[model samples]
Target: MKQFIQGIKDGGAIGIGYLSVSFTFGLAAVSSGLQWWEALLVSMMNLTSAGQFAGITIMAAAGTYIEMALSQFVINLRYALMSISLSQKVDKDFRAGRKMLLGFAVTDEIFAVAMSREGEVSSQYFAGLAVLPYLGWTGGTLAGAVCGNILPKTVTDALGLAIYGMFIAIIVPAMKKDSRILKITLLAVAFSFIVYYLPGLRNISSGFAVIICAVAASAIGAVCFPMEEEQEGA
Candidate 1:
């Protein structure tokens, strides 16, 4: 019980950061012709920042259902990978039903926090960590949908920086710990720029570009940094 409470406290701190960005998501939804409740429902179900943004953008642009579905499929495929990694950290006694319920809460931020745990993670602790952020994300979207029009354009522009900041926060520590991550980061940036400029690839859909980048990067990483026998055991 104590550990569970601690997880909620930890999650609440992280949730505060999400509030600002979700506000923009809400605003965009309303501006893009979605009802506030629909916007809120999207946030609640997805619980992912980039995926939701891409999905809404495609929807607003009158993209085909196939395009929207494919975009989300590509963007969110990372979560599937993250879940596989996290499976090793869960308590051995955790039931299938519990895992299914908790699986839906696996966002990048939550996975990062959970992976950093020092030992096997209890379901209670995981659930506690999920609660506040889940609520904050849902509530923040609603708030933004309702109040977006009143916010200054400059403030909204500045709020865009938050996503970049969040990415940096996630990347810096990993880069500091592993030269492989640094190398991969550089490679990804170079590859992205190349794709952005090269005429054939530049015109491709963003969803396809993301799939290419992820697969190429992961392949390179696997070749360069194959897991050791000991790591396989863990």
Candidate 2:
């Protein structure tokens, strides 16, 4: 019980940082003409910054269903990779139903925290950790939708920086642990920016750009950093 409470507390601490960025998301949704309930629904269901952002953008513009589907598919595909990685960490006895239930909460931050655990984790702990962020995300969107343009532009601009700050927070610690990861991350970021800004590539949709960058980076990393096998001494 104590550990579960601690997990919830820790998750809430990280989730508070998300509120600032989610606030901006909410405001954007409202500005795009989404109703308060609609904005809240997106946050509650998606629970992903990138996917929600892309989905709302296409939605606001009344994009076709195919476009919206592709946008969401591209943005959320990382979760599939995360799931595969996490499967290796979970107890073999973990039930399929439970895993499926918990999978909905598998965000990048959540996955990082869960993976850091040394051994088999109680589902209770994972559930506790997920609850606060889930609420914070939905609550922040609701607040933003209700507040709407009431917030000054300067405040929104500052809030917009929160997502980048969160990414930095995740990366900095990992980079400290592994210089190799740092190098890879830097290379990937540089490549992504080049592709994003290049004359011909710049014309591609942001969703497609993300897919291309992720695949290229992962492929390059795998080839450059293959695992070594050790020989046994007789």
Give the per-residue lDDT of model 1 (tens digit) for 1-234: 887897898798779878877887887776666778888999999899888877776776677777788778877887998898889899976678999998999988888899899998888889999988898899899998887556676765565555456557767787787777877777776777788888878777655565577668867977988767445311
lDDT of 2 by residue, 1-234 (tens): 775786697688658866876887787777666788999998988889878877876775566687788778866877897889888877765578888898899998887788777786666777778888888888888888788757676765565555456567757788778666777778778878998888988876655565577667757876887544332110
- Local lDDT at 157 for model 2: 58
Off by over 4 Å in 2: 149-234
- Candidate 1 residue 48 C-alpha distance from true site, Å: 0.5
Give the clash count for model 2. 0
Clashing pairs in 2: none
Worst 10 residues of 1 by lDDT: 225-234
Model 1 misplaced regions, further than 4 Å: 149-234
Please give me the total number of clashing residue pairs in predicted model 1. 0
